[model samples]
Target: MEFLARATGVVGGAVARLRRIGTPARQAIGANPQIPQARPQGIMTLKMPVAQGWTDGRLPICAPGLRVAAFAADLDHPRWIEVLPNGDVLVAESKERPAPPRTLMDRAAQATMRRVKAIGDSANRVTLLRDADGDGVAEIRTVFVQDQNQPFGMALIGDRFFLGNTDGIVAFRYEAGATSLAGQGQGLIGFKPHGHWTRSLIASPDGARLYAGVGSLTNIADQGMEAEEGRAAIWELDIATGKARIFASGLRNAVGMAWEPVRGTLWTVVNERDGLGDETPPDYLTQVRDGGFYGWPYSYWGKVVDDRVAQDPALVARAITPDYALGGHTASLGLCWMPAGTLPGFGDGMVIGQHGSWNRARLSGYKLIFVPFADGAPSGPPRDILTGFLSDDERIAYGRPVGVAIGPDRRSLLMADDVGDVIWRVSGA
Candidate 1:
């Protein structure tokens, strides 16, 4: 099986290169993308080669009549963003922390991942950016929280601030207009070590509850289902108490989530499992329902079984289909729902940051887009809001956008570009 998988990947890579030529640059997008049939898991899947491709004095190209500028530069691998009520932007400058290799395969996989821009030392800190003069660029930059473990998500409610670390969730006492945190944070819960280390977090609208997204330990539960306990799901934690419970299950990796303003529904962008050809089950953006099972290793796209894992008839019976597909291997991670009139021509819709792909031969994503919404659901096809993250050669990437949030001005969009180490602000021309 291993030999067959390797041979298949070699042939597939050749086909992928051919398809890359003359094909529309942004073809792998839309509501229901064309998904390839599931194939046998590959032994050594195609790993994209990363290059330091950013040039000095260069900026990304934006949509017509839109402008993109570096709001804050020289950031340390910023991955997430949040705007405080006081109009300050909090950026989570984080990177993945790989675990000690347990086997030769583990070591090999880690090394390959490094070539594709996955491995990095966690900054373990959050920084605050203030544009006191109402300018697009931040004039005041300070470390908001420091000395932590792979922190990714952050939330603030009154005097309390919550942060989601790779291993656990913690809270700290926050003071209005404060620049930095000097005291210890109280731990709420710890997660399983290793695999899909990013833990995204958000607070409820009323501040009564908090939600944290924890990804699966391995693709397709290769480490055994027992290892998946308390993983691959979203947890709803009561802010008053340190208690949390599974809010939704069967999500492979719900990286980014938000609450719809009209219906108050929770939506997320999930990164699905890989090794199944260039496209099989597309990653999706869906409205998450309580106790919903959106299929993981057992099935995909609602009851379409993945033969890779042991099939449980009963589990597959309850799998729910996602609301919208963001294309296979797009790695759509950053999600933010904007209300009507947040920006001109962009009505109520969700802005998603497609973090690009390393598993496929021809890359997809690498841009920020908006999915128009109406009647509390995704209504129209995705429209490009920001482009030009990758060079025309397609072999080198200038930046990979990871997070998107409405700026304090409520008229501009803020995005975190991890590769370029800059926070960009976008506004209408």
Candidate 2:
């Protein structure tokens, strides 16, 4: 029995790889994608990608004519960043809060993540970095916000600054050139926490409203819709009144969001459900319409119903198709739009931080990609911006990128590598 089990395991691994990785990159992107559902979860033990931190004299690979410099290092799990108006960068050094493993499956999953070093003690602070001499490296580093819950996203509007803590959104008063916030922030609104802790924030062009992207409490609504109340949707809040309402719905894990420069539409990078083999449903980038449903649990990639989910047929019928697919299990967390002239060779487009994969036998993401926009929509295929996060053999990783932001100078791009604990600056060579 033991020998038979071992042989079966090896055969299952090979089959999973063949089913997951054969799709060409071109066929996996754009308005339409080739999504092939593999075996559902639990048939095989989930594969956990190993994390091999950067060795001596190593850096990420950059595109030709582009260079990467270490903007800041020695951070405790830096996951998100914001560029201030004065060209200062705010880095959120945070991790997920520890909760009791409620089920056997959850405990097993936690063990796997701990082995991969995916979970760290919550840093609960935001650090500031400033390149005063116009160089790529930041000479000044200070604690901007500290002693908070696991903070993720940040935004600033005039004198009022907003920070998204795991359970609530907080407001702070700001002064130009100040390194740190003076006191504890006032909580503006509270939401459900624990599941999908990253709450990404962005403000409107006119600064009249603030938007927060809150991910679902569980994958595929496994805990039922009751547990997902006020989750898996973007909330639009009035800056003055502090009132909030859902802007969009059915996005499983919308981690990063930005406004398209030309069309002024809100776009988001979503991490879709897993367990349906590797290539079934592609994680996507889409223009989020108000009150729009992108089909979570019930269906995916428009109207392809997921047999695993019990749903109201009515909900699947209303499911809107995403604009573009970013590949399966990529965990595309960071999204930013680059204005013209920010970098040479790279014209107007969006920069994404793919934090890499963990479900499939083969690894995906773990690099920065640029999707060029022709008239406010993603046009050409995604171009490699900075790679080499994985080892030459692709079995281990040097780091995983989580958040991306264009520097306030409008020339450099800042990437937060959570596992490597370094912030990389990308500029024209």
Candidate 3:
């Protein structure tokens, strides 16, 4: 079996490379990314970069006029970040719980994960970092909350702190300057876990409700729609009443949610369905409507039907088009609104942490990006905030950026590098 698995992976990689030689060049990105014809391969592309962490004073290269340094290091898979009112930084240290392999494809996936250093027992904790002297680096590091089930998104509403665990949303009592959460927490709502298990949470401006992003169970409902029930959509949970409803449906995997500062509209960065070739459907950033639907299994990018899945013509008709495309298979995740002047030379925009691609012949995203916004939407092309996460040959990744947020000082940008186990701080040069 070991010999067979090795042979299969070698053959699959060779086949994927051969197919990519004839694939069309990718089209424009950002505001109007071109969607190409689907050419699903018999063997999916699997070119993952090996996770080789940073060493010997190595650092990610930032865009001109910007500088970056490690704010905090030696973390355990730091994936999400939240800034507290008292200027304390909360880092969610967790990863996906490994599922046992059941098939050849499953076995191959597990192997790939190991190479990329993705398979591991999750830390299941959130740590607090404090830079008491207002310096760029953190001097204090301590576990803030622990023994949770893959906690990701976090938001503090008044005296209650809500955490989006893989299975549901849990709320704990919070004190203004406390470092650790005292109780086990109360489960507010439950969600079907595992498949795309990162539940991202964001509170409404008025703090009346919390919106959680729940992803689809399979790539394109391959496990049947029954398993995808109450998923592939963002749910609105009323804080006082504890009632939740589908805010919007057919989102596939909406990971990051933030309000447009100018227009006060809710926006999200979604990870579209995969296995439709590399560039068939682009991941996007768009204004999320209260009761809108973006195509997932049935369609993509506004009624561009994905013939691989069962179709629904009525639902396809109402599928709303996204505002901007990040690129195909970019796995665009972390998103936060950047107010004007937060970083020098950049105006108000959205900062994205593209975790990079695993199932594409050519890599797409492994850096931090800033999309300029005007009025209320994306106005200009994306600017590279930080790069050089990948090596010269693109075979080794020193880091993969995830959650992005402004630092407590309101002048620095903080990003989580899960592969490197470092929280990087970016500031003006």
Local distance difference test values of all predictions, in order: 0.83, 0.85, 0.89
Best by TM-score: 3
Model 3: pairs clashing at backbone N, Cα or C within 3 Å: none
Give the C-alpha lDDT of model 2.
0.85
- Kindly list the per-residue Cα lDDT of model 2 for residues 391-418, writing each as its tens digit: 7656577899999999867898999998
Across 138-221, the per-residue lDDT of candidate 3 in tens digits comes to 999888999999999999999999999999999999999898998779999999888788999999999999999999977899
TM-score (all chains, Cα) for each model: 0.92, 0.94, 0.97
Residue 229 displacement in candidate 2 (angstroms): 0.8
Count of clashes in candidate 1? 0
Q: How far is candidate 3 from the true structure (C-alpha RMSD, Å)?
A: 1.5
Worst 10 residues of 2 by lDDT: 1-10
Model 1: per-residue Cα lDDT over 1-429, one tens digit each: 344434444554675675445434344345666566676554534545454535887788888878888899888889999999999999999888788878655665665556545676778899999999997999999999988888898889889999988999888998889888876599888888579888899899999999999999998998799999999999999888767899999999999999998899999999988877556567899999999988898998888899889888888999998989887688898999877676777888999999887666567789999999888988888989988887776657788889999999899999999888899998988
Cα RMSD of all models vs. native, in order, equals 3.7, 3.4, 1.5
Better of 1 and 3 by lDDT: 3
Decreasing TM-score order of the candidates: 3, 2, 1
Report how far off residue 191 is in candidate 2 (Å): 1.3
**lDDT leaderboard ranking:** 3, 2, 1
